[model samples]
Target: MQATPVNPHSSPLVRVALLAYTFLIVYASWYPFSDWHTIGLSPLAYFSEALPRYWTFFDVSINVLGYIPFGILLMLACYPWLPRRWAALLCMLAGSLVSGTMEAVQTYLPSRVPSILDFITNCSGLFIGILMGCVLTPWLLQKDLLRQIRVRWFVPSMSNGLIIVALWPLAQIYPQGYMFGLGQLVPVLSNWLNIYLGIPIDLGSFIRQGAQLSIEQYWLSETIITCCGLIGAVLLFLCLLQPKAPKARLVTLLIFICLGVKSLALALLFKPEHAYSWFSPGAQAGLLVGCLMLYGLAFTPARVQRHLAIFMLTISLLVINFVPGNPYFTDTLSTWVQGKFLNFNGAAQFLAILWPWLAIWFLLHYQPAKSTNPA
Candidate 1:
């Protein structure tokens, strides 16, 4: 019996995941990014201050749960560079360093309170994550089931593309004006201008030229947005996959995952009864059409698929950002309870608003060395 050959190269996917998660951690920690002032105390005041008098199990759990993935990814990323034991130690130290820096900076933010408890809990999460990674990394990166599947299905160089595709479902966690609609920068830009430049601008409405859209117009806009967004995201993934990959199964799974995330987000943010409210007639028609389009394009040339992905993403981004906000969606948003998950919702909104843009960038510039499908 021959021993299975394990790829000796470092996994780019793990490295990309580590970097992405680190960015998310930084963004989530300093959410809102405003109202910074120095209180004449050292930034390290949190280090000397006693434990926070007010803390909850939920807060501690959230802190812990947040850095676990970071720790695992960091450990794996250090692999093929550093020894396993060293990588574990470095992961813990790096996690503590990052948490401490975040806490130190929070001292200047009026809305954020730096706490030692958070630092400790974050370290604990990193420790746990390192241990878990130790147990799983060998099997995953070596000759294991997951490694086999990845090698067999996906292109060898798909670090960036894979990350973008994986984040698609997560981007749907934030409520949107239309189903599968994302990258609406108009509102975000408008708010920024209003705050900083005192220029009250509604870019979306400006694009509409003060014209009110009828019910039919809204439906048409939504259907176009949904179809384009779905095709863009699914085809982006398809471009990364090998010719022999299970295109149908994977595409269906991706759509279902996005739908499930969107439904769960709606239920959690609003009422459970309204979970499937996004499944409007326009969305249904869009989904059907998108599915049919993808089925036909499954066997298309990889280069054509990549170009179509870029084109679809560009269309979705333009339509989603230019279309005025839907009144019905506004009313539904009014009912949302943004209580404990304010920071989380903010991060999700950031992802939703930026995902399509990132996907477009990837599609435009990233040409995988192995993206060509082998017959």
Candidate 2:
């Protein structure tokens, strides 16, 4: 039996809902309402704070429940455009990325601590959302409310772009130590370059020495950031472009290379030690996989690329989890948990160990393109 297709017109509200839910989760995750201290509970709180045994139903429920709407709305927004079965899988992968980012951010928050259980719960919420969308969209289409809403505001061509623009700032939160914008990296890099090479570039020193940054530094940073944004937009545009336009592929590749060069140059000035690190074999492999995914998006008619990316990510994660090099990986799970049970700091350390692989996974699976032609 052929499945019914979702109306693209129905997507704007769904997108808005998804965005709202994402905002709420981010806000709530940062500001917990009922921690032990706030709730007049003991500092020796055992239920939520106890190590290893901290797997309470309350925590699980909250985490999972919080993300369910995110998953459902994302699915609704992408539905019929994204393959239905693949939508669920993609949601799970995306959910994991969001959970991972949220957990990473929690490290900096004084009140919040990261946890594996949260990851599990967030992913589960995405799964539930996908389930709900699969079942609910068809029924909703039979009603007049969705159609009425769609008529007023949903413009298919612009909706996805708007969503992407909204998400750009959120993506910035992933790279560590980046605050305000990429502008911050310039001064640090300028200082490093001036110190190491003994070349007197006073711009960096001036900023640090309490002198207001000259228009040059500010404009340069803004220009670089604007270029970076354009590169990213082009890449996404390429994904959505018709496969017949081979020129789009070339353009996207050029944009990517340009951005890579720009990033490398900035890194050299700011952190020379890590500037070439992106070229390391593991990182290169991830890059290759990402390129391949993009190529698939351009050329493939079937939606297999999405599933393939998900599979690759899952396999990569499994390898990272079980590989022997890291002490966390080599140590027995029981021993590791016993040593730092229920502590956010410990969970954060654990996450840090796995983050490289997780990053690689996202790179491999990151698809900004809307799949218009369904398999």
Candidate 3:
């Protein structure tokens, strides 16, 4: 007897979603909630907070509840491609690996505290999701709901944009100086351009001196950062979309969203007050341009989009890091390293903040060009 063929669409969607969710968990685990400093505790202190309450209904319910979808989705994605037993085993491994990684990274986030509960909860979610998928697959296939959902919600073209939009708010959980989202790079880049080009722009001062949009004492600085930042993120996603590589597009969007969520959480953990300050036009415009660029790239050939994505992200990362006055050595080395070398404070700070992300991105094999081209 011959084995049945897997649906062309199922596997890719599952892989993309799984990879993206993994990133999200890692991002969320790192950032802790506000009051971390006032409590005189590290971000991982929350692990203890969740401990005494571990056995309570809330803890178990939340843990198991949250991951049910993950497990189900993982199972659904895998079942079509692998043997049932093998798929189950794979799901379990994937769940554990993702949860473990998130817990490990949590140690570095100033606001994020690692916890056994989170690991357990994440695993539970994966397991439950897998189990649900197993139970529902047969019925879903019978009713054709599986195929319907896959075609409708999981289709690469339609799903990619929606998933990114959904993940947008989640990414804002991290509180950075920039408001909108991970697009903090925009304002930082803007400031860098001003300084490098000898253009006079006083963003810092503009932010501090309360600018009003009518009667409200608005922080125009935050508004510019957040709005423009979000636009930039969206554009970044759009730029990576490849018409022939739906799977790649889906995967990219998922990863981006997860990163966005984690970034937001970290922002909140470190600077809760600035959590709501991410709605700026500069950031928004950047995001819009980014989205346009992504759309253009999506229509381009796969090979070109891949390199372009990598180049864009790399440049953005570099700008975000190099342009800022190093928070760590700015005062001490202001005179010596001003234009020639390192801003001790800025470099130290950038490293402190982004090193974890770099590590995760590296470990995850984050190839901007890796695609879902079945061919």
Candidate 4:
């Protein structure tokens, strides 16, 4: 008799990933998180309004594209329980409901508009996404390709790594004060607390320009930030893998993937000419040091590797947050030609500023049992 495989739908990784993404979608659609004023305005009224005349390709495209992953992930999560066809249909329905609810809520916020066009585009995006998921799941889920990949490439217990690695690159889509120094959400959090709860926490670390860095000092600081950031990310990936998984090769692949994502984000946000502009002298130095660090630590015990990842991240965060923004480097923040990018920008920023911390928290919370597997 053939043995039955474990149900993939019961995975904590999938459930948590779904919840995290849902939270992000909700938060982005209702950002600023306050100033909610609904003076005799029915949120549903926007659905009956005419199409938006002032929409741009960027807005429409993002609206359609942003929820694709939700559909894909939702379908994946529903597999092994619901039939594949039902899962895809349910994903589309859920996406439509989320889009509709977000659109309706937008009516209450002065900063956001409830647009019929946005609603339609959002649903359209979800539909395409679910359609894609339906096509891909046949080979990916049903054929047990996901299981094969996981068994071959990852530590059996560390399914969480899939979500982390998948998100790691995309987190770079948001602009950062330091290259790859993500999860610097402290100042943002402080500001929100002060405004929302009258906490009055001092958040001057973000703005207080202390002693000016000598040209060399600036480069050295930048190098450390880059090195620590890269090493921490890679080390975490290494720690999550099975004993026999390919380390050196996978590390190289991960590095290339991150670089590609960063390059793509830079190109899309600014001119293609400015894509490599992020490769500053400091960042270059950091990359070398970080790689050396990764080489040394790659074979460490998994528990030890986790400790090192946390330590490196803590040091990097301290240095990056303490240092003020570079005056010499110019950002294209004010030059955005249209309003279409605003929502997308906010979502990416939210991810970039929060994912690292969340990753760290997950690592800290996870205590492996005595079993040989991470599961």
Best candidate per lDDT, number?
A: 1
Model 1 lDDT, full chain set: 0.84
How high a TM-score does candidate 4 get?
A: 0.86
Estimate candidate 2's alpha-carbon lDDT, on a 0 to 1 scale.
0.47
lDDT of each: 0.84, 0.47, 0.49, 0.75
Q: Pairing residues by index, what is the TM-score of model 3? A: 0.42
Candidate maximizing TM-score:
1
Sorted by TM-score, highest first, which candidate order results? Answer: 1, 4, 3, 2
- Can you tell me which runs of candidate 1 are displaced by over 4 Å? 1-8, 48-58, 144-147, 368-375
Off by over 4 Å in 3: 1-11, 31-66, 104-115, 139-146, 149-156, 169-211, 216-375
Per-model TM-score, in order, reads: 0.89, 0.35, 0.42, 0.86
The stretch of ten residues in a row with the least summed lDDT in candidate 4 is 1-10
Q: What does candidate 2's lDDT look like per residue over 1-375, in tens digits? A: 135554554545566758766765665565432332344433223225434554667567756766787887877776646556666667768777777777666655556666656666788877887789777766665354665543332223534433443343333222222111222334345566777798667553444464343544433333333333333333443433444445454555554554455355335223444444324333344444455545445454323433443444344333322221212212322222222222222322223233333333443545444433333
> Candidate 1, residues 212-237: lDDT per residue as tens digits?
87898899989999999999899899
User: What tens digits encode model 3's per-residue C-alpha lDDT throughout 107-196?
Assistant: 554554467766776687777678777777556643567556544433245344334445455544433433342433435545766977
Alpha carbon deviation, residue 368, candidate 3 (Å): 21
lDDT of 4: 0.75
lDDT of 4 by residue, 1-375 (tens): 122343454445666688777877887888756688887978899878999777678778878888887877786677566676667667878888999999899888888888989889888878887777667666676676777666666665676765776688888877666788787766677888898799987564535544567778878878878888887788778877777677898889888888888887777776687677679899888998888878879877888888888888777877777765665543554443335456666778878877668777867875542324334
Candidate 1 clashing pairs, residues 3+ apart or interchain: none
The collision pairs in model 4 are 155-242, 157-374, 157-375
